[model samples]
Each structure stands twice: as C-alpha cells, then as structure tokens.
Target: MKHLTGPAYVDIRERALRFVRDELIPLEREARLGPEDPWPRDLLRRIWKRSNELGLLKAALPVELGGPGLSTVELCLLKAEIAETGALFALHVLGELSGPPRVGSLMNFASAYQIERFFKPVMEGDKGICFAMTEPHSGSDAASIKTSAVRDGDDLVINGRKHFISGSPFADIAIVICVTDPEAGPKGMTAVLVELDAPGVRMDETYVPMSGQHIDADIVFENVRVPAANVIGGFGNGLRLGMARVNLNRLLHTSWMIGAARKVYRMSLDYARTRMQSGGPIARFQAIQHMLADMATTLFACESMMLHAAMKADQGEDLRMEASACKVFISERCFEIADKAVQIHGNVGVTKNHPVELTFRQLRLARILTGTSEIQRNAVAREILQA
Candidate 1:
C-alpha cells in the first residue's frame, strides 16, 4: 500500500472521498430506489458531471487522454476508498461499473478515430459504453464465443447474442468481440465498436442478478452492419485487446471486495458493541470477538495482496499469475469476512434494510464475475506447472 502514498495521490484521494461523502452518499437512497430498479439516468449524469469536474471520472486513464494519469496502485487505492463508502452511487461516481474507464488498459489500443468518435464522448460524460464478449455458451472461456462478424465490402455484418453484458441497457455503444475468421480460431476474433442504435441491434432483456442490480442485459445483433473501420486494435486481435486490461481489472475488482469487507466489518463492530445479548453486549462474547479479529486480520491481508498486485502492474510486469492469485485470495477472504459480519449481526444482518445484506450479496458475486475462483485457481495452477 506504500506505493499508493504520495502528495499527488493524497490530494486526488481526499478529493474523491469528499466527493463521495458530499455528493454521492446523500443521494444513495434516490439512486438505489429499489433492488431491481434502474438507476435514474439524470442522477448518474449529474454525478458524472461533478466527478469529471473534480478530475475523478477518468482518473484511471492516462494524462494524454484527458485524465490525471494516476498509477495503477493509486487508482486501485482510490477505488477501494470509494467502495469503502458502501453507497450504491459510489460505482457511478467514478464510472467504474461502466463507461470508458471500465475498459481499463484496452483503451490504449484504440485507434484515433475510435477514440474520437466513441471514447471521447463517454469520457466527457455525454455517452456510455459496455464491453460485450460473453455469449450464450461462453463465460470464462472467451475463445468459445460464437458471435460472428462477416466482411461485406467496407462493412461487417454482425450476428450474435451477448448475455449478462453490464451497462448494455444504457450504453450508447458496445465494444463487441466477434469471430472474423472461423478457420483462424482465436486469432480470427476481432473487437469492433458497434453503436447500440445500429440497425438490427436489440436490447433483448435486462437481468437482475443476485446482487439485485439492473445493470446487465442481453443484447442481440442480427445482421447489424458496422463499418470495418470500427475495428479496434486491428483484426484478429480481440483476445489480445481484451487481455490487455485483464490484470488491472482483476486488481480493481479485488479492491472493491476489500472495501466492501471493511465497510461490513465496521458495521458488525458497531453492532457488536451496542447489541445487547445474553448478559451483556455481543462484543463481550468471545464468539463475536473472534469474528471481529478474523475480519480485521483478513482485511489487512486482502489489502496487502491487492496493493502488491497493483504495484506489479504499475511496474509494467506481467500479472497473469499475481492478479489471478490476488483475485482468488482477496475475493474469497473478503467474502468470508462478509459472512462473519452477517453472523455477528445475526438476523438483522440478513434483512434487506441492512447494508450488510447488500454487501454480502455483492461480495459473493465478486468470486464469480471477474473469473470464478475455480477459474483463477486453474490459471494459477497452469502457470505454476508451465514454469
């Protein structure tokens, strides 16, 4: 975490905290009106505008791209702090769950035209974007995506269905990965920028996952013709373009889990200290004390592992193993911490009114979303064996 400390980092971090406390937290109730309700677009736009003015909207991007160009460690630390606020609107404050920054390092590979037409508006808080790669049959196995894009003179006809695409319902465009040359296998795949309003493009259905957020949708492309110029990072390089941001994305997700765990730990601590049980407050019981100690200790370890991986990324080191290991360890441990928080709060923790309940559900999904724990473990095992 030392890598995250510096005068510049401190200034940006404090600003982000102030923005979250002053701007986002107060509106959490309105932003999260219901478990399955869509976020009010007007509210999100206001937050985005304010965050952009504060230089926090694109904080993870490079300076050349209209951002402050914070290092990976600093960006991850900032994300953790925002997530620590435990407000649903925190995701919108930094545009983490969606928009240009969510593309992560992949934006580095964008063509000038693509950046100007697609990326700039999103960065400026005027438009939105979603990464579309998961298909009906493909989840963690990206190579198996069945989405096909065939060349037709200067146009490409795209036909596929992407499910569980985050922000698709509201995004103006989607960075779609499609099979350009079936015979070439993984090398045949390419990433294309497809406007959601294109002909034959359909927002099929919205999904409210276990987290109860209506941020994901199923998108169908039926002969959606896009100019060949929309291709990103050249043809047959979609996998590479997508993998470019995988390491940093994993670390960021881990930061969210760490922050959520911290929030729940505090909630549980306050509950234990005040909730009367047996002959005294729950904090006096060894059972509750043990849970608090475990939560605190594991949180420290999770933060250390996440920051170390983030530092490796900042140093330009390959983080295939480190990121997966960090994701696996932190996600699992923090989820466990959330479970302990629930236990310490007893029946009250599981109720919908309690923040711990939402935190529990959200942290549970972390293990499955950005590569499942089994997938991460397999990645680590493969690396170890090959080495």
Candidate 2:
C-alpha cells in the first residue's frame, strides 16, 4: 500500500530512471576514476538547474514549498532507481546543494533567522552544509563527544575537532553537535549552526576512505562564536534530535544499498549468460542458476524490509527498531550481493573496466557508516529488551 499512485508517481519514477540511465550512468568512468578526481560540478549544476525546472529536484521537499512532496515510499522508490547509476547520481538527484537529503531536520528545528540565513541559501544552491557529528574520538558513541560550547552573553564559544565529516571541505556552513554541559552526559549535547568563514573555524584536510570514491574532512573549531539563537532544538536536546535525523538517513541508506545490490545482481546475471563455460553460457548451469536465485532472494527480502520501514515511517510509527533492523540487514546483504557479483565475474569483477570494482568498495563502507552492523544490532536488542 503506497501513499502515492496514478500517473504522477509513475511519471516521477520513469523520468528519474531515464535521467539516471541516460544522464548519470554515462559518467560512471569519470566518477570512479579516483578520490582526487574532480566532481562534475559544472555539469552537475547544469543538470540540477534543468531538473529543478522539471520539478525533479523538488520531489523530496514538501508540496507547500512548491515541490512534489513525495511520500516516504515514493522517495524510496525513486532513490532506489536513481541509485542504480551510483551514489553520486543518487545524491545529485536528491538536491546535493541543499546539503544532505534529510536537511529537512533544519526546516523543522532551525530558527526562522537561521533558516533565512543558511537553509534557504543551501536549498537555493548558493551554499553547502555538512553534518559535523562524528568526532576524532566519537563515532558510534556520540554521547562520548568531547567538543565543548561554552555559553557567553549572546553567543556560544565552541572548541572542538571533527573528522570524517562528509562535504565539510566544500561546505560554507556546518551543523555541529557539541557538548554544552559535560555533566549532563548525552542530554547535555546541542546542535549549533556555524559559518565556516567565522573566525577560528578551519578545514584542516580532506581524507579519503578505502573506497577512494568520496572525500571527508577534518575540521577544527577554536573559540568559534555562534550566536546562541543558532542552537537547534534548544540545549540538552541534541541527542534526541540527532537520533531522529539518523533514523531518516538510515532509511535512505537502506534503500540505496538495495539499489546498489540490484545493480550488482544485474551485472552478475548478464555475465552469467555471456561467460562461456563447459559447453555453453555459465548461466545455464545449475550452480550459476542457484547463485542468481540467492541474489534475487536477498534483494527482494531487503527491498521488502525497506518498504515496510518506509511505510511505517509514513504512518507516523516510531521506527527505531525497524530502521536499525533495515540498516543491519541491508548493509550485510548488499555486501554479500557485491561479493557474489565479484565471484561470478571472476577476474573481470576486479578490473576497473567494470563497475563492480567500485561497487564492491563502496558497499563495504555501508556497514561502517550511518551505524556499524554491531551498533545497530545492539540498538535493536536494547529496544526489544527495554521495559
């Protein structure tokens, strides 16, 4: 039961598919070249402008804002399809200039002035924002963050070091999570908007992950003063609000993981049919058939779970457990799918000529980012055991 139907949803999906297949997939080679490779920023900007004219860029935003206001299910479906081209394509379609896909959190929690100053500029593509929560020491244990934001007369003087923050290097602003009261533990945390150009804010360097597909940055704040009004959700409410943002992001990750898995499966299936074996194509063999079967089954099950979670979310259900379960299941299964794709393709899978090499590397990070498999399992167990 999807919340959207009729020609409108179908049109959105079809247009998105054509865009990914025709516009984005052609750039796979350039995009996967290396971490130091420059992004197709100008090309992407042109496509973005065209997409906005066609209403594609506005699909994730609310309807009242002159956008399509897609439901969770609709957004997931479109995202999964867009993801077939790759992460960069999916992100571009999701309005990369607006920062992350779930920057809706800012719309909900940011002050009117902050929205006018930051959010609007980001959405309008004049600026970029990065989430600065994962610290040098605080990755999964966000409660363990040591960054401090000392209250002053009309501002908070912040001092901290954040690394592995995506988009930080190119961002003009950052939503930084800091400890406003060390004594209050997680409850003492707060989210503050900081202008990267402000004094004492520095982008130390951009670090590449093992995949070497994207770059994250190390940022240091030394006595950076952010007006007190920039605080989101008020002081002592950061953890709760941050978790809320995580749930939405985890859901998007789950859907895109499925997309990447599906792409791997397709590559494997094509190879199986063409790669010669004993007498004919390997796809005719029972073993190859069984492998494809397993891949399809895994993809179907993961997609089902993703849709279930999305629907639950649309119905206003608390998806703490469902979101974690989806993240854990999809991450592991997507990796397995990619592994199977590699095994099926043998030597070709590892070659840069095919997309699997890049897919394999990116899928591996799916387990670690958003939340680790171990962390998500603990979260699910904790929720189930709670009184």
Please report the candidate that would top lDDT against the real structure: 1
Off by more than 4 A, model 2: 1-6, 25-36, 40-48, 64-66, 96-100
Question: Model 1 Cα displacement at 256 (Å)?
Answer: 0.4
Clashes of each: 0, 0
> Candidate 2 on 1-387: residue-level lDDT in tens?
444554667888788777767766666555564433545545555655556655677677767654577777877887787787664556666674334353665577777898898877666655667788888887898889998999999999999999788766567788888999999999999989899999999887656776674447788999999899999889998788777668867887787788888988998999998999778999998877888999999998998899989889889888888989999999999999998898899899988736787788888998998889999999899989993
**C-alpha displacement of 115 in model 2, angstroms?**
1.5
Q: The CA-based lDDT of model 2 is what?
A: 0.79
Error of model 2, residue 171, in angstroms: 2.0
Off by over 4 Å in 1: 1-3, 30-32
Q: Which 10 consecutive positions of candidate 1 have the poorest summed lDDT?
A: 28-37
Clashing pairs in 2: none
For model 1, how does the per-residue alpha-carbon lDDT over 131-170 read when each residue is reduced to its tens digit?
Answer: 9998878999999989999999999999999989987777
Per-model RMSD to reference: 1.7, 2.7
